[model samples]
Target: MDHYSFDQLPHAVSELHQKLDSIQDLLLESRQPVPQTIELMTISQAAEFLNLSVQTLYGKVCHREIPVSKKGKRLYFYKSELEEWIKSGKKKTMSELREQLPSLVVGRKGRRH
Candidate 1:
């Protein structure tokens, strides 16, 4: 260990304190609760979240049309997957379709640009 003179003691202590403060900050940050990525919902909760009737939801589940997880008699849905399922049925606007047309036309049997 390097011996510190009396004059250097306060400076060394301050530097040590700063490093401790940095470590404490990191510890506090790590202790913070992380946001949830997968939110599981029951069938009734799924129906409420999706604004659909329970009967209709059951019909969709029976037909294997919607994203679902089945455990014995219980059905589970993930909020993230349900949101993505809703987005997957989105109809493109005319402008959106036009924007995608060029990419779709390239290297296909059609009139060249």
Candidate 2:
């Protein structure tokens, strides 16, 4: 048999209510629709994000140099995709390449010159 003193009753009930409220909140949140984390930007918004003129952005889009999405007559860009596109063109400077040459020249399969 479980023994409950008067003082324990209020504490147990309060704890139970708090746990039930937490469960209810979790259920409600689960039923709601989640918003997308990656927001799609309009052409003008994309240009502003990239610090480019709208015309320059359009030209890049026309040349397939930039990532874009087309819906009917409009264009859209994902900020995440644009960031990746920008990173794709990253190149090491000449000095950096020169610094790496000695290590690359070592461990050669052919005879050293």
User: What would the TM-scores of all predictions be?
Assistant: 0.66, 0.55
Error of 2 at 2 (Å): 28
Per-residue lDDT of 1-113 in model 1, one digit per residue for the tens?
Answer: 98999999999999999999999999999999998868999999999999999999999999999999999999999999999999999999999999999888784757757
| Candidate 2 weakest ten by summed lDDT | 104-113
The candidate that wins on TM-score is: 1
- Candidate 2 residue pairs that clash: none
The deviation in Å at residue 23 for candidate 1 is 8.7
lDDT of 1: 0.95
Error of 2 at 89 (Å): 1.7
Evaluated at residue 1, the lDDT of candidate 1 is 90
Clashing pairs in 1: none
lDDT of each: 0.95, 0.94
